[model samples]
Target: MPDRKKIAVIVAGGSGLRMGSTIPKQFMEIGGKPVLHHTINAFRHAYPDIRIVLVIPEAHSAYIAPLLVSFDAPPSITIVHGGETRFHSVKNGLATITEPAVVFVHDGVRALISPELVRRCCEGALAKGNAIPAIEVKDSLREVDDEGNLAVDRSRFRIIQTPQTFLSEQLLPAFGQPYDPLFTDEASVAERFGAEIHLVEGEERNIKITRPLDLAIAEVLLATNK
Candidate 1:
């Protein structure tokens, strides 16, 4: 294996509107720590020397240091102000990179991301050039149209998650294009950039904490893990 830098670009620009809290979802506490801290820790746990580029709303930047201090031992991080949209925020995060590396663009709210999954994504990306984590959709699906709603086959679909890993060469240039509403995630942006996406199994417990209920669930999961 070649010696390559591992970089994590974690985006957490949510306004906490969904969670109904003044604090951003990423800053919300779970297991006695901010969700964003857990996210950064997950990457570090996977690769202790991995570089972390955290993109957060400008308003929340001040709270970051205190949160890091809460860690057993704070790790150095490069913080960037988020952009107007998630796309722009991620673009800003990608701009911080200047070297050849394996980049994992992850959601800061997905605090439960496991070290195993982080390593898995890195390995898949290194072997195939890019790797996106996804899981089989378990719920029944419905298609709504002008006529009505119809049940669709859930087997053919997968729920995508992040820490979408890619080589910096492949991922960096993809964000160079003008922003589009269709660029929902790193995978979407890369797909539009003409890179074939490779999928790896994602953990079911790796849930994105978007609501109060999610925070509660995460607390339970964290306790169970311990």
Candidate 2:
């Protein structure tokens, strides 16, 4: 049986500068609901008993609190103030989970993530100390330089995604170290502390909404899934 008390941390602290949006991408609408709302609903639908901690911009908590009712989200979800960086935001979210359980660190904009995927990630983390959802890079890889020049071998690269799952005990301690600007995700933090990560096949449809064009693609994906 899976750990019924598993916790999830949804990181949504980005300014959406890359997307060129005034609002954070997580707060943007997708298929008639906010992206973050869809992301949280996936976990809730997958594991009704699991606890959720949402990491949002400190300034947006008051704005988001009332919006929860619009999404019909559960009252069980707790909102934490996000830090300056994604790494720190995850750390803030992780700090709120207070149990011996498996935890999932998910990107709030990756709303296409399925409940089945979430369950698989949680199960993988429970069986292994750390787990990351990844898809084999089918396209030929290239390493680009600062001047957009190509370099090096691409054979070993794989595209990784979330929810990256980990044993709560194993993950919480890794966050205690000094923050590094280079840390991109939870897996990097765990790897820095010498934790072994097991990889599971990630769904191709599980794409992050980072650009304007992606929203149209996501709408099509949502329609197809329905």
Candidate 3:
């Protein structure tokens, strides 16, 4: 087969409010390095030739510039101001991707995502048009009502994560639709456009850091991997 097209995007616009930190979760140090830096390095290690597009809050771009410089980030890396929500931020990142290559949309907090997982997602997207890394829900799930009452079946759920991959063409138009708070991720947006999304089994370690305790868990994983 011919070579697969190449592009990757990282969304890091989290305000850290949930984590109750003064700084954004992406900038928080994990095992002596920023979470976002580790996440980007994973991709670079996997695909050195892939162009990287990063989306961050507008105010933080200046702060991140020097970090990129110190790390000697790939020359192909480009930064864009992020939007208010994850969906919006991804849309902003998508706007900067000018090529028809396949793209992987990842969360910066998911610093443990393996290079192999990223490659798998990208390859799947190339063949299927849309792909997302997901894992079967092992815990008993419940749909709670507005009044905190259990409302649905527990066996029909799956916990989704990212490095959600897509063809640039398929994804570009999906983001053009009007924004909705209900739209959670790139995969959701694409699905709304009638894109067939394939699910790849994701690694258990591909966790998104949302709380202070999560940082501790991440550090343990990083140390074990090292």
Q: Estimate each model's TM-score.
A: 0.97, 0.91, 0.91
Clashes of 1: 0
lDDT of 2 at 130: 77
Error of 1 at 201 (Å): 0.1
Error of 2 at 198 (Å): 0.9
| Local distance difference test values of all predictions, in order | 0.92, 0.84, 0.84
Model 2, 1-226: lDDT tens per residue? Answer: 4544789898887666777888777888878877877888889899888888888888777658644875654448888998878888898998887778889999888999999999899878878887899987777666677778674465577799999999988899999989988688889898898898799878898898989888889989988894
Q: Per-residue alpha-carbon lDDT of model 3 for 42-96, expressed as tens digits? A: 8888888888888888888765855576476435678888877888888888888
RMSD of each: 1.2, 2.3, 2.1
List the candidate 3 regions with Cα displacement exceeding 4 Å: 69-75, 146-153
The regions of model 1 sitting more than 4 angstroms off are none
Better of 1 and 2 by TM-score: 1
| Residue pairs with clashing backbones, model 2 | none
TM-score of 1: 0.97
Q: How close is candidate 2 to the true structure, as a TM-score?
A: 0.91
Worst 10 residues of 3 by lDDT: 66-75
For residues 1-226, write the lDDT of model 1, one tens digit per residue. 5878999999988878999988888888887888888898999999999999999888997788778887898998999999988899999999999999999999989999999999999999999999999999988999999999999999999999998999999999999989999889999998899999999999999999998899999999998983
